[model samples]
Target chain A: MATPRPSGSGKRPTITEVARRAGVSTGTVSRHLNGGHWVSPDSAKAIARAIRETGYVANSTARRLRTGRSGTVAFVIDEPPASFFEDPTFESLVIEVGQALAARDQSMVLLLAGDEDSAKRAENFLLTSGVDGAVTASAQPQHHLFERIQAAGIPLVNVGSPAGLEDRVAFVAADDREGARMMARHLLERGARRLAVIAGPAHTPGGSLRPEAFADAVRDAGRTGGAGGTGAADGPEGADGSVAEGAAARIVTVRHGDYSERSGEDCAAEILAEHPDVEAIFAANDRMARGAIAALRAAGRAVPEDVLVGGFDDSAGAVAEDPPLTTVRQDFRRIAVELVDALGKQIDGGVRANVVVPVQLVVRDSTSPARP
Target chain B: MATPRPSGSGKRPTITEVARRAGVSTGTVSRHLNGGHWVSPDSAKAIARAIRETGYVANSTARRLRTGRSGTVAFVIDEPPASFFEDPTFESLVIEVGQALAARDQSMVLLLAGDEDSAKRAENFLLTSGVDGAVTASAQPQHHLFERIQAAGIPLVNVGSPAGLEDRVAFVAADDREGARMMARHLLERGARRLAVIAGPAHTPGGSLRPEAFADAVRDAGRTGGAGGTGAADGPEGADGSVAEGAAARIVTVRHGDYSERSGEDCAAEILAEHPDVEAIFAANDRMARGAIAALRAAGRAVPEDVLVGGFDDSAGAVAEDPPLTTVRQDFRRIAVELVDALGKQIDGGVRANVVVPVQLVVRDSTSPARP
Candidate 1:
């Protein structure tokens, strides 16, 4: 009778090869890699070395193909790294995006295009990873990868508006500026006199628009001032040095952050230091709003008591905070619903364009009549 | 020369067929699906119906694989339904897990197994989806699908103990009981005389082990009964309705929650109400600890002042809470590290088993000296 075939002999140098090279049993090689099994660190290191030299691919690809799935998607977000996971608003978006992807039998892969290096890595990963399509969220106009993504001609869906990308990429995004304007109008009606705005980074995509929209609403209401009162003239040497002044008091102060929660806290602290009598602080997103509340409390200023705080993005955590936040609610779920629907189209060979969702204001405990 | 291809004579049905059936313009159908293009709400509904009837598959599989990747890995977690996204600890773990998988040239496909139905769906998705491997974080044993995972022999790795699944699966877990015991010892040394333990659900795999470990440590320390008191065989069903003899005074009270922050608050409130002089509370996880702190403060109790508080799982958002948490630190990063390493091994056809990492106590503002 033929001798019992040794395991993995005719095939490639499997675990047995690594075991032999490390001068240990196959079980030892397995345990060393697993970490829970009682194996000496020395033995683990030897096995790792052997495996590296043997050049054995993990071979998950063969199994993956049996299910007929490419197994991944490109989740591209045009934002700073610090702000990616730090902002509750963005975090909620991520959760929703992830959930939507899961529902469609797809995986939502997060790609941070904060800087050039990360962007390059993200683009390379997207192109090579065998993702069916790309989901671009809040991309800036300056993102060089936009062109590359378009050129690759793979199905691409944009989550938010990228400056010039509306012409080429299909996308789904909330009407951000419209939401900001609505918030501004609410604050005005609530009699917010000394308004201070905490905006996101102006150089980035959404940053320039929110403040601009707020200014537009203020102007349309005949309240005087542009999106922000002072432009390039106010503090050209200050953080946002270039401010051309219009109506300064109605739009009293504008401070900028990279849209990170930590930055929100710092910005609030700075704004409070500069304008102690400020009554209403309108943060661009829920994360910044939460930070502002924390700062206000630390400074002994009560929320909606000494000051009425309003934010944008009705993140789930905002409702559970010490005081539930009052802010403009962007329908992220709806946006996601539309986004996936659009992605299905692009991959089905549809032309690229932008899809916009409406935004609304959600009132809660964080804002109130300026304490009589 | 070959006749020029007719403008609309493509192999696949043009956007026109989808639009014609749906009674909408080709542009509307195209925009509704490609993501970025704008479409009227009414048209969107029609297009969805048409696409469904057409049996349209995006064919992302073929197009994406052209670049040589399916780009996905399955992310598996065992959490309760409502607590899935509500619990920051679990949420952060998933994000980190996603990050790790992404780092390894893969994308994470999220699979939530919070209940029986969800678990079945997750198991189906795991098998059917072509994922590279599964990062199973289910803490509930006796899950029928665990056996399925074992039989299928995919690169399955559990984040918690694989209780009855030792032989068939591999896993990466933090030392839960060890961490609990260490915290118990710390509390005892700090002179937390009237101590109480607010544990997680008894049915949960982690919950059962933690309380047992705490009991062991208390016994080892010789701090079971009050210095001169006999074990209580006569109190009204102890605060949590769990029988407690007077002899178990030093480690007296015990209650349980489904492991929610809200439950933490409730447990603290009930225990304090029953035993007003109780000096310390040990919550099973950080979320519960946070709730307890909120409840304590609301009832005029100062954390670590009138009472000391500690928790398990140094989760995200814990350090950032009002008074930073003092708790047992279960290293999720290390867990992720071991998990990826183990998965890489299994994918290489190496038979690996369970791995355990050490747990340590993390001191924060929540715990302090008992009142003088």
Candidate 2:
């Protein structure tokens, strides 16, 4: 089917023609087309019909010149193309954020700064593109895009905790530390003594906080003599040694992945080869957990029988896995909503608000005690 | 870590401060910041360092008023949020398109018109946002966004063949019909007699053309009497009753899906229950094909031993499946590049150019004869 074009003289129709055809004042037609909020249903229908009849197209350039607000916001990603697609959290964030912005009559422009050059270009674009604000998800620590957005003076909100820029920008993030604590404790409850973790990249907030919290939980379990009691020890020492906890003896072995499935598989293999008696594996995200499962199968171990596996981010992959993954669910949708809300507030001249959404642990077959 | 703020007195930095720190003329600094195409490396570095030091932020509102172009484009999606994330094709398209636009120094605004209200809001946003152009991927037939975009007269391009609006806009799509023909012939060559197809939604161009081409291949094979010949008489009537092919006699039975994995699984199950003798199943895309494999496994039918399964769009799922999927490879990156190139042309006052990229069949373990 072809687009029904304006007939006869091959000239485009005008607003005047549309107004005349609709039998309404030009102001009514204009307002109806602009938003139609105040326009009555009869007039809106008439205006819409007239628009179809006359083939009149609104000139956005003139409207933008008059309004000074473009109704556009940029959703920036600091990762490469492959990573963007492979990560389900990014997908969910983008979808929910786009929908939230749409409900507010704003469009989300996606910007990818996968490399230094792209970041430079994105910085320039954000500075000059006339976007009302910007929202970012899963930004790596020290990513240049954060500084660029700040330098552009755009109202910005990072979906996750902006590692180093938390004080400067508005941000909404899931409680990664709390979620990890829950997962680690659950794994210990399932008769796991020697625990291993496939941690995310150290440069990311989720990566750093999740594993740190899990390590603390393991140390706490060790202090409690493998029971669920609160230990007298504070926690495990921070990976950097800058922050100290009571315990010095290590109970959890941690391996890092870049939040990719392949990385999870490789790390899991390395951990298994090095710590053959490890009873539980907690991957920082669902994708890595899936990889860990595959590696476990290859190594002739049955999940929840020989070893228990737990993961963070109850993504679609968690549900789809053979023995569905036991995972911590980060409410990405809520985070998206909060990001938009924070960005919108800042755009409206409100002070930046930092938000941390709650998370929950979902038990599944991968960690079920019934599995022999 | 906090963003390093401008120290002392709390006065915001100005362009003059940046110029003074860089030891360059204001005009030179401005030119370097705008595009830096002709600026020397030393001057550019000095200007960047000076801007960083002074904490100088560009006034985007003032700059937008001076320049008519907003340097923004909308990447529109007509599907729901769940489908948007579930389909790897959409993920690839959005990422690639965003990167392509970024390469041209343009930011991509994502607009999701999942429902009627959202679509209307998206139309209004597109009509008033001052975006230079728009690009959409996988637009279904009768999607209202297409007409709204055309009526707005903004330079627009659809990433796939948009049914019913073919002549009105620019588009770049992978060759779906030829790809389907290749899959069908491959299946027949593998000693398949009875074949069933899990088709995509009929309202989509891919949904319509893929099955038609496969049927044509089946009829052609029948004419050669290769154990499953139903011979050429006249082909089944096309959806529009237009393009005539070979024969109406049944060689391939089809079930439809909305291009989702669950739908593929459900449709495959139904086909197996109804046609127990079916030797091969061709799913329209890899996600559905993965579902088909899962269903086949549940039914105790081993892949390539009991039945062969082929799919389209060799997505990540194709490689990750237990028995990796044999599917058609559509170069999504190329399509994205072409989309940006097309939109760029239209923005540059060039007429619409329709492009069709070639597709290839990727053979994997799913179609290998090892199961029996």
Candidate 3:
């Protein structure tokens, strides 16, 4: 065997130096740095020792240039710019995802595709910007952004369940359905007979999944005799028969909102006007719940006294509410970790399935003394 | 000039094709694409025509590889992650900055350096990552992150005025001092004889400048006969001799907080406890103003009725308050635009000075009925 010789002096060692010290070609050293695939254990050990001895630090950017990978991922938000700031959940998710990416020596670029113009711009940037992959959040099922991303062949991971492209993309989502069921069961067990729901936009997965799951729980609890659930009553046939049956005994009205405080307040006002004896209100998210609380106070109803309000996404606002909020907690940190991991797998040419994180219900002053 | 020639058929045109048709070298074509500083106008026009004719599209990533420009900027936040979500001003700045960067076809990567470990990580990443530049927000004057960023030779533009580094770094900030003066004049003119200030952290530029300006306004108004202002009275050495002259007439007390709602509430409660007859309270920011409102309400004081409250930053919470906040609006959008522009200039090897955007006072329900 030829004795390994130092290639250069007074400069940082490159892959060529490591290869020369390891008695192998630079390609072998490059492959070793890129996960050591196809290299024998003996060669891998020699290369590792050579790297350690020669102080050869691999430049990730140079490696990316060689492999056509940017080592950067885009965290695309499919909401308006204002919503990016207004929603605490989005903030938490973005921070967690950025931190996670940072830990893996990767960078995350934030892209907002709120409207058609922005969507087109974001799509073009992603297609040609040399980003290795993407993690998207808040995309509606029918939004063409997903189709464009898919067509561009970029590795993708969704923060929430993708509506129609379930098979084509990987996702990580909190179990909104199970969380709604838990909220319903808790409320019902606390003797909340008359309930009202401030649902999110019908086009969103959380909007439909949360309300539908709550209705299912109510039906399973025998509160609404034969109404089946909102899912059944909302069918295209306009089936009012089951809804009429449950209309008299227990008032379970669902009003839709855009998951904003003002929208929640408006929906709550409408619900209160129509159903005067509503004992409990479930807002799809915390901001909406806060608005519901405000509306109740405006109408001379005290939270957890005359009415109990529950929220989802136990955000900072949840604790800051007057009576504090009884809400469901989605582990955003875990979801972010899973999202980065899934995207990493996809970047490595592996397919990943959907990941569902569990949710927990937190009881606070808003729903502690649920009255009959 | 050489006759223009068509290149390959049924394939993407390369730089060679454009160079051939333009009757120039490939180096000239690359230089033109990278911004034709040295190329003649006639040659530039020829290259442009050739590029259009040959449909030659430069690959941004490959160009970046050759030039070592990533076309990415990091928007770093020195505050904790929770603060990023809690403070509306931070959110607005971030959103506006992202939009401005998007317009320039640049990507923004958010980096949170709240803790020591994270700050170290951020410094390391910025030092090694191929990011073109950085725009940092919410960095305290004493934080060593600025030193590291400067030593690493990264072009930086701060969203707010940096203290000691003001001379060395470019920044964009609202006129906090002028805004505070306006608030003081407005309050004094409305007959708020007994005033209190909820000052921001003493170490920060806004913290020091806002309170000092308010004190200067009071001195200029001659409201506190010879006390100079809060800055003089609050300094060490018991300056009580001067304070005593104004203590019996116009009581102005200063309490400091970390620009948080909870801190504002605590400071306001302390102020109220010490001076029950205070007619006006000015919190450093909107969240603190909201907290002051809450504290007043808890003490059975109605805003603008029992006491008047004013805030800074005219954030989302200002309008959302029960009695809308009368506050100073720092035009975050303009500041973001200026920051991005400054960073771009710096990236082009141009030096820029600190930029100060103007502020406006928004009169609303909180202070319209200012009490005597």
Model 3 lDDT tens row, B286-316: 8888889999899988787767789999887
**How do the residues B223-262 of candidate 2 rate in per-residue lDDT, one tens digit apiece?**
6654223332223322122332433223557888888788
Our model 2 lands, by Cα RMSD against the true structure, at: 8.6
lDDT of 3 at B273: 95
For each candidate in turn, the TM-score is 0.66, 0.75, 0.69
Model 3's DockQ? 0.10
Of the candidates shown, which would achieve the greatest DockQ relative to the real structure? 2
Clash count per candidate: 36, 8, 0
Write out the backbone clash pairs for model 3: none
Give the DockQ ranking, best first: 2, 3, 1
Residue B206 lDDT, candidate 1, scale 0-100 = 47
What CAPRI class is candidate 3?
Answer: incorrect
Write down the C-alpha DockQ for each prediction.
0.04, 0.20, 0.10
Deviation in Å, model 2, residue A81 alpha carbon = 2.3
| Predicted candidate 2 versus true structure: per-residue lDDT over A18-41, tens digit per residue | 789889988887676555557665
Scored against the true structure, residue B270 in model 1 reaches a CA lDDT of: 92
